[model samples]
Target chain A: MEFNAIYVIVAREFKKFIRERSRLFSAIARPLLWLFIVGAGLSRLVPSDTGVSYTQFIFPGILGMTILFSSIFSSISIIWDKEFGFMKEILVAPVSRLSIVVGKALSGTIVSTIQAAIILALFPILGFNLSIVQIIAVILICAFTSFSISAFGIVLATFYESYESFSVIMNFIVMPMFFLSGAMYPVKLLPEILQICAKINPLTYGIDAMKHVIFKFETGPMSPDIPLIIDAAVIILTSIIFVLIAGKAFERKG
Target chain B: MSIIKVENLVKRFSDITAVNDVSFEVEEGTIFGFLGPNGAGKTTTINILCTLLAPTSGKAFIAGHDCIKESAEVRKAIGIVFQDTTLDKDLTARENLIFHAYLYNVAKDKMQQRVDDVLRFVDLYSRKDDLVKKFSGGMKRRLEVARGMIHWPRVLFLDEPTLGLDPQSRTNLWEFIAELPEKNKVTIFMTTHYMEEAEVCDRIAIIDNGKIIAMGTPEELKKAVGGDVIYIKTTDNASAKNEIERLFKFNVSEKENEIYMTCGMGDTCIPEIINTIGEKVISVRLQRPTLNDVFLKLTGKTIREETSSGNDIKDFVRAYRKRH
Candidate 1:
């Protein structure tokens, strides 16, 4: 990626986020709602397992949820770009179109990471302790997840004509990824079919990986390590593939 | 020398040939209008030449770079302001220009200065920090023009630059566009469905049905059919058309509810032409056949009346909304 272009794009996205406070509010609200209300209620309903409290177990899920909501919603700008004619200006620019796509994805990723971090910060308030390394790890994981998801969002933006259609697809694809990834409940507790589905879900790997580090009830020793690496790889790989797809899609006029 | 050359360029979307074997050359440092009826392939041709859409066949070159093979170079040399407002509504006008400047790889310090200059040029300096969504349609369009100038490109592609603006806004935009050639030496290649809009160009290529039927200086095109046009308004327009066609045996087109015909030797012919039609002609006016007639003479249709219904799906959205 061209660093200058990337910086500009990210800066633009950040400014846009700041200007559209309602949009930011909605993005921040959804995950924060999930973490507070849904996670709180569900934790009491399910039998506690594996020395992980409800908040700790659910922390990783929120990271995936954060990535999912923020990344997909970021494609809203693409629709706006097409509508407002800024896209034509961007498309006709002298720079590599790939840089434009990467720039868009990076912008989305950075914002998504910040939103994810905001949600993560709520953990200590809810009575879970995160090590400095754990906090750093989750940020990277969330950022990567956001990039991959936002890249895919851009790919969808090329094919979708309206935000209604985009939101429908996000509901169809991302909502399922969240539920199936064992975001609310551990995969071991799901039905056999859902469990199978969860294992394949990139979200599952992300959630499971984060679970290895989050400390709740101060009971668990240093957690599992290898799976987080594997999950990180999946996210990085997905980011690479979807970003390339987005770049090609942006190059297309129709 | 021609700064932009398009030869036998064709583009098809499934069954429709949006752009047929259209060919034209644009001289450097002159404003060349690409005129056509709606759906007349003006936008399609512009899109192809700007490297946004690939031509089905033939070729186009911008600033010596082939559009297809050297797309990036073409992109660098040409700036496009699309017919649709392409502003980032969330950003201020200045911010939007800066984004475009950075995309074109303008230096950071220079980006600020250029952003200010363009905003000033568009007369949006007062609203520079105002979000674009708050601006009027004309304001947004001017900002789009500013965005196009961010890179300081030599050739600018404007696809229907003044469409949908109020008459006052259109006039403002026209005056701004008219000054650009003299001010910046920018080779302006613009497409417009509006016949009157093309008249402002130094030269225009009137295209219809994916073909350029006429290409020349606006005056030359009008003079080719005749030195000027004779407008005869009558309640019996059909009869008047028949009588005129019978006498002159020339092509004609109508616009704005007025029937117009072109003829050579306008000074001498106007009196005879009016007398032949009888005095029932409520008013007789003679002026140059406009770019509109040039378009009509080439294709057997009026350029103003042919609005493109490119997709049924877009219609469905509106229809579905009404039903609900």
Candidate 2:
């Protein structure tokens, strides 16, 4: 809650993230591959129902992928801390477990948002244009999405035993969520059950929102930006839930 | 005055009773050694004292602040250098110190000075700008101590402070820690598995199997053994143990290679016993018992010489994780 505590946590997380150049590299690469290579190649392969360019149709999903991956991958740092006994140091400090959650959430969400920013920077170059305010809203959308997913990752980190096991779990959890969240194709592309599954996915709203921003997909059937607002709400709520859970977990650890 | 007080402190993890009914007071300006073997709950006790783990029941207070009720104050009052290293290897010594200062909310103006002061105190000021990843084993351990001091804590908790150090480094750290009381009346509570190491503490509680076996100053504990010690080098220790048990009534404890007996007047008892058991004797020796001897008397087991070896896979990975 205090300024100095927050600064220490943020600065430490920042230092850790930057010092591990691999985290920086992988953070950008995962989304780029999904958006450019996977999204672009699959664009021509899938029949275009929306009648939009393949890359354009999936831009939302790709951006959502950006948020999901960044948040999940940042958890590696947590595992690293546990392995290195840094968690013990942080645990023993004068700061509250709640502040720790806040600090990790803030730094992780911001860093993940920056990864999305890298993708956003490439968006215009890829010929997807947005007005300046849309750009600001997009960053906020990514931030919230990242916040929710990263909070989930942080909670998982407490339970994670080792880096290798953490990687396996992350793959199982994150990859499915990425594909199932209607990021690749519209939810309509799936079976009825999958569509139902998509309805529960928080990324669906986030992706749908990004899609509206990038592709202007809200025409007659869907409100211009209803999904975005809904996704944003779910993300904020989930982030709050995960932070509280993580806070309680850390409190017990102390 | 006692700077630390614990009353019936108990800690449990599911069915495992890690520490039970452990209570002690550490006097101000005194280094209280908490001595125990591996799995002896030494770390758990220190964890409770340092506010890192709450007792499942009972209470512990640091510098008069309750660990449960006033954890924030307790955390502020004490510094802990855990058995495992906890420094950020990616950062320089100065950066690491400053970051810890920020957590303690040291003023920005004072933070740099404190960082400088601690680094110098640890004899690490010259290498303050070097990355910790580049540091050797001793350097990393020293930095952990320096980091704990950055906030100028009123008490310091060191869990197995020299568990994995070479003899030279261990000696250096002991001297460094022993001087803290003179520098300031900072109450020092350190856990150590090494029996010889605990002798330097003003007082020690010998803990084993999640309980305190004995508690006293080194001299008091040594006095607990009474007169000279009789160490019997027995090829048949079991028979030797039973034979010695029937022979002396004062106190007797045996291990693999030796049978030890303590009596009221060893000068009179020892020679007669040596004469009585002459034919079966390997050798007889009468000497002063060290803390190790006292621990052997209390525990009825040899003081284990298990060094913190990195040869084991688990230890290597754990140590590697601490650094990398």
In the order shown, the candidates' Cα RMSDs to the true structure are: 7.0, 7.1
**DockQ (0 to 1) for model 2:** 0.58
Candidate 2 ranges with C-alpha deviation above 4 Å: A47-51, A220-226, B229-286, B305-324
Residue B167 Cα positional deviation in candidate 1, in Å, after optimal superposition: 1.5
lDDT of 2: 0.78
Measured over the true interface residues after superposition, the C-alpha RMSD of each candidate is 1.7, 1.3
User: TM-scores, in order shown?
Assistant: 0.86, 0.85
DockQ, candidate no. 1? 0.58
lDDT of each: 0.78, 0.78
Model 1 spans > 4 angstroms off: A49-51, A83-85, A216-226, A252-254, B229-285, B307-324
Report the number of backbone clashes for model 2. 1
TM-score computed on alpha carbons, candidate 1: 0.86
Tens-digit lDDT string for candidate 2 (A1-254): 66787778778878877888897898778777876788678767766555566676666677788788777767557788888888788787888888887787777788888878877887676677688988988898888877777778888887776788765776787777877887776676578998887777777777777776777656632223345667667878888998999889867654
